[model samples]
Target chain A: MSKGWDPGLVLSWTVAVIVAGAFCWLLGDVFWNGLGRVNWQFLTEAPRDAGRSGGIGPIIVSTMLILLVCMAASLPLGVGAAIYLSEFTDSEVGFGRMIRRSLEVLSGVPSIVFGLFGSAFFCIYLGLGFSILAGGLTLACMVLPILIRATEEGFRSVPSEYRLGGAALGMSRTRRLLYLSFPAALPSVVVGFVLGLGRAIAETAALIFTSGYVDRMPSSLFDSGRALSIHIFDTSMNVSGGEAQAYGTAVVLVFTLLSINLAASWITDRWLYRESIGS
Target chain B: MFQFSSDTILFGVLRLCAIAAGSVLLLVFVFLVVESWPALSNVGLVRFFSDESWHPAGENGLFNLLPMLWGTLFVTAGSVLIATPLGIFSAIFCHYYAPSWMARVYRRLIELLAGIPSVVYGLWGLVVLVPLIRELQPPGPSLLAGIVILTLMILPTIALMADAAISNVPKQYLHSAAALGLSRWSTIIGVVVPAARSGLFAGVILGTGRAIGETMAILMVCGNVVQTPSSLFDPIRTLTANIALEMAYALNDHRSALFFSGLLLLLLIIVLASLAETVRVRGEVNV
Candidate 1:
């Protein structure tokens, strides 16, 4: 007998199509309504008018600062740990495995959970009181795991023979790592940084507790500023201008991310591609 | 050897710090349990697990997350239902049908999608999606809204992983199927799908982990309701949203419970991520 019609496939297919359709339409909607909200003043000035639906100057500026702060903290810590682990593996694979596995577990911990810890530890316990430092440190903690993993992968990809050759040529292990291993792995390590920073810029829930969504431009590290992600979240929930303003803010955030992430990804991808291809 | 003393000591401290990263994971569990002990002791473990209402630190102080759990399950299940098939299909097409040039372009777009933040996705949902669903009902931030947003947020991940999985299924398997008088279509369904089942599972697991941990987007779109999802268009909260919405005002037992919830959510991600990672390596072997 011929198999009866498999209705499950049909139903699942419909569901999938509808979901994809909704995402596509949402982007299309943004383009249509979003273009009208964009203006030269919107970029240069803070919300000159009262209420929300304001320009993104402050939020954009805050996000950039947060990125820089998180990068400063995570990069050295992450890369140093990676270098340690990768170098140690030549002699002591057991210790390397422990570091590697821990980094993996750390990466798996959710961002929101990190937000809680950060709030308790950074904002409250340390008396930082909901400021950029708290936000930056929290995001740094979150990104550190990913950065370590990526950098370790980069280091692992470098041929062991090269390191041995350097040692044989009278270069000390430290010098070998600094001049050869590091240089060889620098491109991928940088790629990891770019990826980590892009994620930090988009994060919100974590920032809510640490970053403090206080409106207007930041005066100092402790002054408390709004990030683009938090700004988008805060603007959406409120009743005032409602969906129209929310859409405008979203469009701005999306384009800002699109332009920056696209450039960063292109550069990183080309760098990684060249490394793989030349090898 | 002259300078080695200083540099070696530096590296020694660096090792302690590296090892300390592992301690942080254990520390999280300790901190959550310690901070939340009062509330857990007050409620007792049995009742905490059984109760369905979640109004901790209220006049009632009811801290039942069952409804939120139900909402979490509902939205995650619904999004998975949507993301899985399309991801698998697109992956199949990407693996077998698309030319190299188009494959690269599609891959790049998918990468861009991955790079876009969850908050932006939530923002997009709050703007366009919630209202559209609201047209179906009032207060557009419903379980439907959350599911739709999660589906979009999760699509790039599932597609990328699923593509990797299908690609991992060797050409020999497909060629063997074809040589055995099987049609291309039948060979794909019969041979490729079976071979890639583990990979597909990995993709779905990764996607689920994502949907589960998702906070900002779901928080923005899912109206903060402490009830089981009655309908697709009804407001509901998940564990993530519950923490985000309540944490700002929470204190004592209430805050502890939020910590408990966060701890629980992290444990879930760890479990799912490990499972996904295991399957991913196996899938890679197929390539």
Candidate 2:
């Protein structure tokens, strides 16, 4: 289907290049403006004078804490749900469809709405009172859909022949899933967790409601903490003289996300490589 | 016997997690409704939406949501208008025109774009785009800035979705169109695009939902002026921004009003999402 030069094709392709160029420009702007501020002190030292001076040490720690808690809560539950949907049930049938539809609905619910829900349920009603635990729980709900979908896809990708072979070997369904299917899906599942972690790391609104913006090291999950995204929001919008610090923080957040994404793609490529070899 | 079995226990645990996932949605709805009751009760549901003023000051209560709702709709529509054609064209180019290696790279780039956090987009908009807008029209933050930023923010989603849809179109159609002596571009526009139409519509609808529900990026650049924007340069507040800005200090009915705003956002999202779902299901049925 190699084509001669067509005006429409040229035009569409030009638009694509323009789109890609805009993306590159945006990334270039962020890195060029923000990367200069990064250093050992910036990464390790605590902020002073309402985050105008010093560094984003506590915010980094807080963000990591919330992310760690969120992953801990979401991964097991998400993997379990994915297993149940793809393995235990005929996903085209009643309960599985219901579960999938709920996920779709939940995924579409705005992050700000999740903020409101977290404020109401986790912060106020549940008496968690604006802490890392509260924020992490809110984020767990937020990431659960992505996790389930990815893990379910991973499980589903384990060929039917593998399942048939397991059954033929007189293995029960649960045993086979635990011993064979799940391990095969581990790479994809890890990829999903990294993606979900990227999102959790980036979240500001949902954390705003559940995680109170205390700009110091939190000793426990009950203490309020600041996340990097929220730090960017506060510094850029509310705090004075924080514009530079905000850009610096944005650079950190963006790079952190980039690493996660790179890890995911690497894992995915590795899985593909292994699959190709196995086939 | 089954109760004591490890397999039964494992299945039960998995099923419970699945149910927990679904139940979380239900709980969110219930919490939102309960919290929003005061505003709904005080202002009355009809007047709440219909009244033009949004003042929550002094003795007399006002919880009008029309202006912000209008702002949300306006910004979303503007973003959709800008992004839709560019996204579709990019998707088409990637699918039909670009070399396979280029398409693969484009796909990865789109994924990377999607992975960038919304707040980072906000930071970019605040530092970069807002300044550019300020030069065009003084005082930077306005509906146009919001629109432009949102358009950039959502481009990846729409492009990726359109790409997926176009890729999913069957190869037989292309073969047949080629047999009829249609050129590559003509075959795409005449046959392949038509086949992928409903899927692309679903993507467009989904993108619209993202643009509307978006908070951090738009909030950073939109100037947060609480009024119906009369022009692209006029700064305006969206429903999400209003709640985020005011929810901290809001008290009594004002707090309830914020929840009411959340309820409105939720309803809008539900409508957009279900509509997207319907379009997707319809596309599947057609296939």
Candidate 3:
């Protein structure tokens, strides 16, 4: 350690403290006002009077349903594309490069643009109407890039020696990929899924037009439903005297995201520990 | 023969998925262009660039988007300006000054910041940030409020990216600096930062992209006024916020004009993405 006070050290510490203080302030503000309103009834009952005097039961259901549809659609496509990129092709070359570039561009495209695309293409052109299906599918498009890149990185991190070893054992390519590569990359795959889930659950702009924001418990995938994020947006922005419920809903949303993030980190940490032990 | 055929089938399925994924970008572009075609033709390209304010309805409806475009750029620039230095300094602190355990915890904190929903940020802004700002000035939701919220939202991105960039600097350089009796702070500024310059630049570009694309938080705090902001306290609206605010009730030409704005935002995003990608690739080559 340096003997006395260093000016650079003071400056850097001050900057870090300021940044950390801002984060704490934001988190503290939300939790302090919001946590008191979140309880058992809040988790189980539907809202009334334009979300001013009731709980968020149906909103939770809708959020999960949208998340479900989004994951169901995105996971297979993302894993398949990742497999092709990392295992079946040279990424520096023609088709692979094109796919990579498309994903990079898609990842950066604004969420509202995805909203416009979803409304124009899915709702109107495909005749899906304003439904959970439209909203979930739009989120799927938004999340595909994250999933594909993460899973591709996972597959790439698997040692080439493992594949060679499987071949030496007379295992077929299909069996080797299914048994060897997939298991090895399972941790990263889960991380990607969780990351995508967090993103889909938090989206508001992309879902509002596509999902039609009904605030009703959806009977089927075709029903227009209000997601939790949209509920927060509406209750806070549009509805009058809806601040308390908005705080509660924001708490639920933030709590869900925190749990998801913690779970992802836990999984990755365990995987890394296990790998280090084995080596 | 059976094994070979099975492998071929697997390849075909995976290839199909890849192709489908690749085509989505093209599909988004084509769909936006097609949907906005009516506005592009009816309003004339020149009108979009004109200085008249956005009034897309009524008998004297003006389709000019210059104000909203300028608002988007202004807010993004403001946030980037504030966030870049704070993020870089915090990254430097975490990488070099903090203990390993503290660094790990700090990183988790940043990830948590990144994970919080944007709508929650908007809600917080509406209730807390706007009211606080309102105490300072009359109207709470102004360009300043939007800039402050965006700075908080994008800070984690730049910090994480800069941390990664700083970590990628070779250890040998540090060892040599120490051997030469250079102070840690001086060595960092003289050797480490310049070496990580390209990656830091990429981080700023990516952060700028995120700030530009942010919709809900900006919409809530920016007052949603369709005029050029003369000062930080003046109300303004961004292109992303404009689309979200007006999309529900918009009709005919107005609706198409919103999509045109979306198209413009998409083009801007594409330009930023390619720029960041080029910087990343060049950085790797240099390394």
In angstroms, give how far residue A196 of model 1 lies from its true place.
Answer: 0.3
Candidate 2 lDDT over residue span B180-279, tens digit each: 9988778778888889998788878888888888999988999999899888999999999998888888888888888888888888778887888788
- Candidate 2 lDDT over A181-221, as tens digits, reads 98888887887898889889988888887897899999999
Per-candidate local distance difference test: 0.76, 0.87, 0.90
Off by over 4 Å in 2: A1-5, A276-279, B1-4
List-wise, what DockQ does each model earn? Answer: 0.43, 0.70, 0.80
Index of the highest-DockQ prediction: 3
Off by over 4 Å in 3: A1-5, B58-60
* Real A-B contacts recovered, model 1: 0.44
Error of 3 at A65 (Å): 0.5
Q: What would the TM-scores of all predictions be? A: 0.90, 0.96, 0.98
List the lowest-lDDT window of 10 residues for candidate 1 chain B. B90-99
lDDT for B285 (candidate 2): 91
- CAPRI class of candidate 2: medium
**What local lDDT does model 1 show for residue B119?**
73
Which one wins by lDDT: 2 or 3?
3
B1-287: candidate 3 lDDT, tens digit per residue: 99999999999999999999998999999999999998888887888888366788865568889889989999999999999998898899898888889888888898889878888888888998898988999788999999999999999999998999999999998999999887888888998999999989998998999999999999999998888899998999999999998999998888999999999999998999889988988988888
